[model samples]
Target chain A: MKKFMNTAETMVAESVDGFVRAHADFVVFGTDRQCVRRRHLTPGKVAVISGGGAGHEPMHIGFVGQGMLDAACVGHVFTSPTPGQIIGAIEEADNGAGCLLIVKNYDGDIMNFEMAMEMAAGRHAVEMVIVSDDIETARIGEGRGRRGVAGTLIVEKIVGAAAEQGRPLAELKLLGDGLNGRIRSMGVALTGVTVPHTQRSTFTLGATEIEMGVGIHGEPGHSRQPFSTADDIVRYLCETISRDIDVQPGTKALLFINGLGGTPPAELYLAFNAARRFMEERSIPVERSLVGTYVTSLDMQGLSATLALLTKEEMTLWDAPVATGALRW
Target chain B: MKKFMNTAETMVAESVDGFVRAHADFVVFGTDRQCVRRRHLTPGKVAVISGGGAGHEPMHIGFVGQGMLDAACVGHVFTSPTPGQIIGAIEEADNGAGCLLIVKNYDGDIMNFEMAMEMAAGRHAVEMVIVSDDIETARIGEGRGRRGVAGTLIVEKIVGAAAEQGRPLAELKLLGDGLNGRIRSMGVALTGVTVPHTQRSTFTLGATEIEMGVGIHGEPGHSRQPFSTADDIVRYLCETISRDIDVQPGTKALLFINGLGGTPPAELYLAFNAARRFMEERSIPVERSLVGTYVTSLDMQGLSATLALLTKEEMTLWDAPVATGALRW
Candidate 1:
């Protein structure tokens, strides 16, 4: 797979440089090039922070703007950001109201973000919320957790709104954890992602094959099956989440149909339509929904379906206007 | 390039299905499936409409919403919509204030839209504005016209704002044409798009080669040249447009850096940063700018740079708020 990047090593730095240039109005470079913080930090507000690997272009970087993350500690593609980088964001984004670190449930992310929090513990009040909303590895009886996927956006937006209202750190953490618990996601990859410098996809799916319950980084999924229609894929993904999370009838949830980079908006919509119809048939009340490329893994041809059962308060917070670079409403 | 679509033949229909499903709140299907109109109508406001081939996901359809186009007649991928389909949109979008047809410079589009205008001659007042802002084929002295590319978005946004303010058909057309005249675009093709159903890319380039000055629909550009760094590409594109369009030093212009699908936001920003640097080096004032995947060619991996010299009124209109699915700000 060919790309327009100059080299794999400089892809992240150049991307961050470009991000600042594009959104110079609302964002600025942090202490390091790997970190970016809001241009005008709101005083006395709980600072929200989120980050992970780099392949997911809009996940942490695009979400770092008004009404969302105060800062994002950008790591290399499919590689975790270092503790020093995370510390830079924490130090820059803190405005006297404690900082909240939103971490996806990846081993490297958890370990790195935790180490960074420990480093910043004495300097400032810091908290962490690990989002393991993916149901692909569900083991509810044994108390095993799911991995995080596109559902991070939901936590980001809701927690962001609450933080904007000056919610305490503990409350925001509780809200974030509760939201994460209620959310379940499952994704299918039609193709593998090619890292920048490598010019090679991490994995490969045959012309007529698909991988269900795949991770954002092309992690092995529950099963590999022959390719199916978009409608079928959406239904299967929604079914997996709905069944694993035990979504009850009459439950009002928000449907997040996310594109995995290579997938276009039209395909996402088609998948969303299928998901909506599936939910409707099952008598699940869809309170709200979003369809776009929120969380991506480079240019992988795939889609993830995340259903978050929102409380009344959560719904209100989710509806709050957000002015981020990737998502605005 | 694997896709999630069921078939190429039904790609347009399925995409429209997904579009309507995702945007059921603000838009609805026009009489025909290819045509889409806003759910709410002001009854006496001038109706703005635009369309072309369907592969440009957000161009015509994603733009159908409040503060933008009232209706869009979607054609097949890289193919023109029938005059009958366009006429349906014209009739449905008219709120008794008249309708404006924004046709790109493609011959099929021009002919179809013209025929549609003739079909709606007596029933409603109709006019058309042809956008030939692509400077890739600049031949001013030969009386040759350029092709329309991403610059159409500027025309649509500006004209849509004026129409929202109850501007008449003739005035809206004139404003649209004038804006189109001031805009110039040139795109490069890094990878050809694979239209749905066929499952084959339109064209291919060697690993180290690129098609410069390409049109939106896979049309060949100035020449195929060796690929270069992002900065070099940006400088070359800006220089080509500058040399051909004769952009005077110190002139204020709006820079629109568009991604032709597949390209990430960070990459678009990277390209934008390079573009801004090029303009700065030449002492050209960038009054305003927009960077996004507003206009795309399916899943093509390339970008287009468009610079529009604006008037004071045009600047105001360009800054006006628009609430479209793909371009809301």
Candidate 2:
């Protein structure tokens, strides 16, 4: 594991410190650096907060800014944040209205966030929206439900826009839950991720193999297949996602092709074109498109395809203004 | 060898098609898809045109939008654009105010762009800005001069903003030439880049080896050293740049930490923190910071650092609004 880092113990902490410094004008360290929060909080607006492991960068933390997440509780790489950290974020972000937690569906994350919600019950009105959009996990019947992946950004953006509009906490929660139903995503990994601390990949594959429907933390996917051309790989991803959502003909979607670290922008765009072609053949037009490395699994050479069935109103929300470290318009 | 591409011959073209489609609202293909140009042209403004090989994305093409580049001619991966392609860009971008061509200092690029200028001489008033800001190649005293690296973005951004303000061709060229002198950059590669056609790395390194001052095309660098910690590597990069540019103790700079490709955001931020500390120790304050994988060598696992001495006027230009595919503010 030839990573540009000092010691694995201090890597995540140093990265958090550096992130705050790099975007100081937009964000600040909150409560002994337990969380990163927007520098300027909006009064009487429902505060939106999110938290997770550190490897999937530009996610919870990068989303902390105007018109998006109010605060992000960061954790050690591939580990869930402590309840104290989540509580600190809640304390720093809650304004007169309340706070809403947009959480991915993971056992550790759900448990810690729930513990933090209970801890902060007396001080702030807190509601939670758990996102479980990875369709493969649901099909696998893990009994723990699906694990959220790249589609979290869609949920965050839409709910964040609604929050910025001063929507009631209940309404925002409902909107977030509704989005989870419409968004479906699946990912493929060409190379496994090596955890910084362990200095070892969670799994390994043969030279001509690829993993389909992999989770964000380098977890095993549904199957391993022979390495194929870009068009075939992308066709599989788009077909699986669209099939999972039962997207109908003439339906419009926001096709988001995301790189899961290590994949260059050229390949990401190439994958986007393949996915676009797939949708066009099905008569399912992709009304909006986003392609980049947003959520990542540390140095994993892979990409994910997400399709969100767009309603006219949801389209307006996704198009709404957002200013954050990783996202701005 | 493991890349998401359809075929070597079609990879760059497909990527360009995908990029134009993804950003249709902001850009369009020009003249048989030889270039990507702004969708809405601003008449009478000096058109800022740039072009180069395809691999380093979010640079020439991603910069084509409002308040930045007017057009970007693209060539095959790691190959210079032909004179015909450059001429197409000039034709598509130029409005009444003429055009400014920002060319990176490469032998092929310089020759082709000059040939294009000669071919289009009678049609439009054109001026050129040749950027050669990589300090390592200069220190080596090669007769060909330094290679332009990540600092080209600084030249494009400042000159692009000036062109957007209706600066004439000559003035924009002069401004871009001035910027080239103030900016310096150097990169390190942990692994060599693999071209899609070849399906083999340009160079190989031992498990504990790393290359310093590596070029964007995976060309040989100044030295190959044992793998070091992030802090030490960043220290070497910052110290080398400061010494080359003779950055005064009280000077201000825009510290840009760019990922070549494959390096994740967490590691990038960690490197940024080390650089910020290095400048702080020298009393040369970093007035602004930009970090991301903007200019990249396809799947090269490494990063580059760039420093541009900032004037109050240049600071304002840098702060001006820019809405592009990869950059927005």
Candidate 3:
């Protein structure tokens, strides 16, 4: 449970500074103590922005660029980026085309981004899209809300492409809604990630156990299940996502087998293989597939499967060009 | 170390299958214990393909798409993909426009991809570019070669864009070479990651030690030093990269603050900020900056920084639209 840092308090600020310095092409702004933005504003393009706790790398920030998000509000490690920060990002990315806030469906994120959206609407035309693609059925009853996991990236990519294509704010919102309906994600955590500030693993499981459907911020998943083969894990995840969104044969789908930080590419590929088999067995057609760590949870050892049901149009949008730190195409 | 797998041997293959199932829009091959291709391959564009060990998630596979890699070969977990796999990828992606193989400068990756290149050259014209961006000064004298780390992403993006633009294979090779020369990377690992098959951390580090210039496979770095502040770490990494290339103020550079698997984004941003400040103090002009888990070690708690020195042409290529699983732009 050790970390490489001077003090817990300075960790977030220090990280932000280093990020801006390394990415000078981005017009970065914000106090050394708070959230920041990239300066390269897409003049007429509808700006896309997102932010949340800091554990998910390449997420809110890595996504900023042409054909993606224009700005990302930074939050503390595992904490929501403040409303003020979101407001600043909105203002900075805002041009005549307005802005889109892609907030993950976490309680804190939803609350903060919602408040920021309200505040910004007073001065600018600000629109928002909440991604709630986590398909853990256990959370359906608590009303805690379906946690936004790896599927957030798909939402960003799809909606970001639409925004880049000059879709109006209202139309973009509809597109976001449409994409969300077509997407679902489920995850399994083998071990917990130690948050640097806490210097302790965020959650714990037995060496023989896997926490099915865990959220990114070290939240316990629906249940702790006996560890199984990569194939079994894929079955569990695919079944969950498919049940949530009826993925039928001949349906064009985008599969994302995402690493939850610490899982190796090999393990992710294994999980992905099982998922592909599951689809093939059912004669379902996989139009596009991505396997790797897109959205991550620090170094937690786990993987999440995100299914984006694609129409021909969505597939075309997925093919649109993009330039971002994490995603280039 | 808990893991989500029934057997160690099947991990990589399963993950690859799941990846294709999840994104069916992209044409996928190799679900049958072999190399794979994306179906979205343009008919006339020169295909870009890259691959290596399985631990480096998103490096080879996540980068496969429209403007990036046309296909990716996934090796066994933590092992290089076989020559047959590489050849398969090349053949699947080849479309009259010769294919470019972007191989990272690893002994295994180099040897395998080289063999594949030779095999493919007999039938389809194949060109290769070796990326050696690791700025680990320690490896300079080894004569073995500098291990390609996160900087491979830059090579892939630039070259992928060039290929997408229908550049000749020779021109793409030169572009890849130019990017390799301009890009430099160095990393520090807080903790080692365990390869699932091995069931042990790839390497060992102390509770209060950071391994500087660690490789993606969890190889031991140049030295284990006392854990320091993010600023100090950034300085060490940046100075190492800067020494390898002349990065002056007003020179636009693409800075990448990449996570080595387990490092949190918060910490990455802190490191990014420090790097930015250091460069600002020195008047180094950073044109574009990226912070995220691009090329990663399975949940290794560390970060790496890559500086892609941008010329006008390189910058244009860098800004080109790319479509992939992990990277959008």
Candidate 4:
């Protein structure tokens, strides 16, 4: 696979270092090298920290700044950070207001962040919010129930905004956990991801085949299907989301179309248009929309559709100002 | 070939419609369907207008908001917009102050924009700035001298800020033209781009080979070279740009690393780190840095590095607040 990287052992560290330098005005490395925290933290405000593998960028790292994540504990590509790294971020980001950990529903991620919280028990008041918004994984209902995907962005954004408003740790956790139930995401992979360490694609498909409901870490999706037109694919995704969540008529939604690294903006917009049309046909009004590569899968060729049923308050939070490397408004 | 598009004929229009809708708060469609203009235009401010083929998105279209282009006349994929469309955008964006066109250095774009300027001769005072910052094309010293690439964003951003400050048409033109000379850019392609219309890649390279100095429209570059590490590739790019223009040891530069659509944030930052090291070793300071996929070539697995020697004033202008779909701060 063709990629711009150094040795696999050093790729993540180099990338994290480069990222901090590029946005030095907005973020800084925590005492722990793997942890990145906001350059200017707001004291007395709930410090919201989130992280996972390094490959899904602009997700955790790009969200670190005012009105978003206070700190992000970056890990090796597609690998979870250790508990020590998580606690380092927690210690650095927490002011007097306490800390909230937003963890995606993943085996390694949950275990590590949980350990970090237990380790920091006496010193800090910590609350954890686990996001599980992947509809396909929910359908399986076996191990881990559901895996978080692009909808995690919505949770981060809304929760981060709330944290900036001086919300307490418990409130922030409730806000994030509430958002998880409202958000549903599903992705289709046209091509697999090549891990930096392996230098090989996690999976392969025929030229005209696609994997629907793929996980971010290159996990096998729901099933392989014949590649179809953009409208058809988006229609299927929208339908699945609507079916998973019993959407009544006239429900307001925040339709988010996320490119999985390799898809271009034009195609993302096409998917957005398709999703918008589908919502319209179902009498669902999309009050807010975000389309771009905010959450990604390490240069994987695909796109994900996220629908967050939003209340008026949630919509206000989503519309709140956020300034970060990947997202700003 | 696995692109998320409906059909080539409808792709641009659909995408444009989706874009305007997504950024409804920032931009709107002009009377002419192909033209996208700022939703709230400053009546007396010099209207800055730009356009090109569709593939390089978030360039002309995404720049159509406050502190940037007033309007963008979008064209078909890898094809220049018609003179009629250009005139339409000009008429829609122009106010009492006048209009300035930011045209990239391409034969079709130049010819069509020139024709549009003549067509709108007595109606609106019009001036054009041609940007050609490609170091590779300049070194060749043939044809169009140099072709504009990622550096066009710098010109638009700086000139757009100047226009917002009530610079006249002629002054804006001069500012944009002057910035072009200070900017130098070079790109490397790891994979070719597939046009939506053709459903075929424009070019192909061997697995272990890469194209250096490739153009935004997938044009042939200086030469194909053996694939190398990120540092080596970025070091070569920085050296070429530094040589093309006699970069002084103490010169302060704005190092911009742009993804060519498909490259992910991790790789881009790795490139940024390498470029930063190269500048540091040369004793040239990077006063500012912007790394992401601002300018793109439509799902081509590649990236470009742009170096703009910035003065204090230009740095201020670069940091000016911009609220657009793709870029905002």
Candidate 5:
């Protein structure tokens, strides 16, 4: 793999160290290892926290700042964080207003974060919200095994704005759940990621082939198909996501097109152009749009489309100001 | 080519359309052209206007917003803007405080923007500054043929802030020249970019080969050598830059490590870590650092390191609050 690391074992740790040192003015390392928290804690406000594997950068860690996540427990690449790390993040984020865990519905992540919640039961009030908005799974409507991908940013922004307003912990949890339920996303990959220490990629495909419905962490998708034009793939992504959500005439959404690591901003805009055209024709207006690389798998050449059907009121939350490294606006 | 576009001919135009529409709140297209300008113009302030070839995003276009660029003239992919487009951008940005055109030092761009100045003569006051900081060229010290790369962002930020402060056109021009002279950058590429409709990369390398000093637009570098570890490359880049500039014990600089499009943020931090270590050992302090994909090539799997030596006062300007889609604080 063409990676920049001393060792695969320390790559995540070293990245965390570099990130903490770079943003030292605005953030600090959490008390209990492998977590990033704000430099100053706000007392008696609902605290928002999220965590997952380390490879998907600017996700959990980059979201730790003024208006977004309060703390982020960084696990090993494509691996769940330890329960102790999650507990520490909860402690740092909790300011007596209680804390909320934004779990990304992977079996490993859900288990570890819940374990951390149980571990912190006596110290602070904590709640959990499972974000399973990835609609690539066969049981999309059932929402049982759906994985959370780029849509987590939507949940984080909405829930974070409400939490920053000092909403009660219960209200914040409900906000996350509601927003998560309304969000749907799917992705296509032109190339798979090669993890550090591995010379080969997780999966290989022909030069002119694309994988549809792929997961972020090198997970296999429903099918390996022929490579198509950007407009056609965007149309396919939009159609799949709309089927999983309710999109009728006059429905408004925050269309977020994310580059999964290797796609350039220009290409992302290309996808956005096609998605916007597709939405306009279908009579579903994209009320707001964010096109860039957000939650990315390490060096994965792909793009994901997320359409979060928004309530008129919720639109205000999504548009609310944020000051994170990745999602600042 | 693995690009996202409806057609190669319309790729740049379509991306501009989507970008203007996505950021419609903060920006708008020029009255009758492809240029992007602030939605609400601040007349009577020294307008900071910049433009060049597209593809290196978040540089000239993404830098547009509150405290940075007043207008950016975007051109076709890897091609300079037309004289008409640059003229329109100047007309939109100038509000009697005079307009400053920040042009990258490319033969085509210099020739075209200069032609535009001649076209807009007497209609609006205009002055120009050329940024030529890329040090990888054979005639590096001569500075005439040096192509401006990632270092252009530093020139834009420093000059933009001064312009926002209502500095006169002459002062902004001087600041742009001073900052551009103080910046130096070099890059290496692991993979070449495939322009739309080309169906092939600009260059090819063996599995374990890397091209040193590659330009942002797939321009050939000085040499292609065997792939090395991140630390080794960081060492090479730092040593080369330090030799070009002074690296005495007490020197302070802003170490900006940029991803050349396809390199992920994790890998960028990896590069940052190596650079920090190298600087620390040399006793050359990196007073401030900005790490992310600021300026990027289109799908070029590589990275560039830019070190802008700064005085004590310049850090405050770098830390100034600016709001744009790509950069915010």
Candidate 6:
């Protein structure tokens, strides 16, 4: 497969520099490797930070701003950002109000961010929230945790809004925990994406098949099934999310139909429409919905749906003003 | 070429339905054709609505919400939304707030949206803003008229924020027009994206060649040149945008490094870093920047850069809170 870059080794650093240059106003370099709050540490506002593998474009970095994360430590392509990077970001974004690290439930990310938090705790007030919103059931005996996927965006938005409202660290952590119950995400891949350095597709799927519940780093899904119609796909995806979450009737929901890189909006919408019909037929009250490529997997052609149950208060917070690269509400 | 769908004809409609379902709170549908404001339209807030082909996911639909677009009419894949669809969006979103139709400068989108605007004018207060941000030299002596591409996002964001602040129709049109002078965009495509129904890539580029100035619908670029480093590509792209706008040294600008779908974030940042280095070397002040797959062309492996010269007021508006599908800030 053809790729675009100077060399595989410089890919992550080059991307980070470019990202900082573009958003110089809201993001800046910290400790040579991490992105920190452009604003001076606010004395009272609790700082929120997160990071992970670099492939998810707006995930860790794009989410840094006033209403979301204050810093994001970018990792190597498909690898967790280094603990040093995360620690630097924490130090830079932390105000007297304290800091919260929002780590995805990936092993690499968890390990790196946790280490960073521990390192930071030696000198500063820091807290953390690990988001594990992927609802795909894990193997019964393996004890693997649900992977974090698009649902991270919902978590960031909610918790970020709360942070922006100047919620204290402990309160914000509780809010993050509360939101954990309301969110669930699942994804499927029709085709595998090629890693630029490897110049090889990360995982393989047959032309007429899809792997349901694929991991963001191209991990295999629970099962490989034939490519199905949009409706079938939606039914399968929504069923998984609904089975995992007790989405009751009359409850408002925030639905996110996310593309994993290469899926066209047309296909995304088709899947989105089917999902909506499925939910409506079951009397699920979808309060707000988002469709498009929010979280992606390079050029993998598939989609993920995240459902965020909302109370009036959570909806108000979700409606709060936000300024970020990927989400601007 | 693999595809996803039960039928080609129902693609756009199904997608729209799905978007509405997911964002049910802020999104409302009209007669199975139009998606519009879920916020009760105020009696006098000027509503801004836009639409075009389905391929540009967030352009028309994703912009819907507070401080951006009130509604979007979606067309078939790579096809303009029908006049009826556009008209319905205008009617549904209009609530005494004279509606503003922000159409991209594509012939089909312009023609179709114009027809719909005319159809809606007799019944409600309406206005329009046609965005032509693609800086590619228009057909010979065609003056400033060019196809609209990624720069439309800046236009939509600034103008949408203004409209959300309850600007009148005339003022919103003027704000959009004022933004036109400050904004410019250029793009490169490494590979053509295949439209689902056609099962054929829209345009072709050699394996080691890149198409500069490519259109969102896969129109040919100014030239196909040998693929080069991300810095080289960034220099080429930044030069085009800078020259087009005559960005003087020390001028503050909003830079958008937009993905044309399949390009990975690493390459995007590499290019973004190069562009930043270029701008900094030239002493250009990048006030705010966004790097990601904001506007895309299905799975086209490419990127576009847009520079918006920021006035103090526009910068504030740029920092304003916004809620939409693709962006939340």
Candidate 1's C-alpha runs over 4 A off are A137-145, A248-251, B137-144, B248-251
What is the per-residue lDDT of model 4 for residues A1-329, given as tens digits with 9 covering 90 to 100? 78998788998888888899999998999994858999999989989999999899877898898888999988888878899999999889889899999898988999999999999999999999899988887655547889888988888889999999898888888888877888889999999999888888999988999999988988778899999999999999999987777564444699999999888888899889999999899887888999999788998999999988987788899889998888798
Candidate 4 is graded, for docking, as high
lDDT score for candidate 1 against the true structure: 0.83
Candidate 6 chain A, poorest ten consecutive residues by summed lDDT: A135-144
Cα TM-score per model: 0.94, 0.98, 0.78, 0.98, 0.96, 0.85
Docking class of 5: medium
**Which candidate, 1 or 6, has the higher lDDT?**
1
Which segments of candidate 4 are over 4 A away from where they belong?
A: A139-142, A248-251, B139-142, B248-251
Highest lDDT: give the candidate number.
Answer: 2
Q: Per-residue CA lDDT of candidate 3, range B77-194, in tens?
A: 6789899888888777788888888887777888898888888866888888888888784464656578777888988888888888888888998888876887888888888887
What digit string (tens of lDDT, one per residue) describes model 2 on residues A43-75? Answer: 999999999999998788988888789999888
Clashing pairs in 5: B1-B199
lDDT of 5 by residue, A217-242 (tens): 88878888888888889999999998
Which residue pairs collide in model 4, if any? Answer: none
Q: Tens digit of lDDT per residue, candidate 2, span B121-180?
A: 999899999988888876566566898889999999999988888878888887888778
Error of 2 at A67 (Å): 1.2
- What digit string (tens of lDDT, one per residue) describes model 5 on residues B1-329? 55677678888878777777788889888888658888888878988888988788767788888888899998888889999888888877889888899988888899899998999898878899998778896353433678888888888787787787778998888877777777889998888878775766899988888888888888878888888888888888888776787653433689988988898888888788888888789777888888888788788888998988875545667777776767777
Report fnat for all candidates as fractions from 0 to 1.
0.46, 0.73, 0.72, 0.74, 0.62, 0.67
Q: If the candidates were sorted by their DockQ against the true structure, best first, what order would they fall in? A: 2, 4, 5, 1, 6, 3
lDDT of 3 by residue, A86-143 (tens): 8877776788888888888877888898888898876878888888898784375546
User: Candidate 4: DockQ?
Assistant: 0.82
Scoring each candidate complex against the real one, what DockQ results?
0.55, 0.84, 0.43, 0.82, 0.69, 0.48
Tell me how far candidate 3 lies from the true structure as C-alpha RMSD in angstroms.
5.0
**lDDT assessment of candidate 2:** 0.90
Query: What lDDT is reached at residue B277 by model 2?
Result: 94
Q: Which lDDT tens digits does candidate 4 get at residues B9-115?
A: 99888888889889888788888585999988898999999999998887789988888789998998888999999999888888889999999888899999999
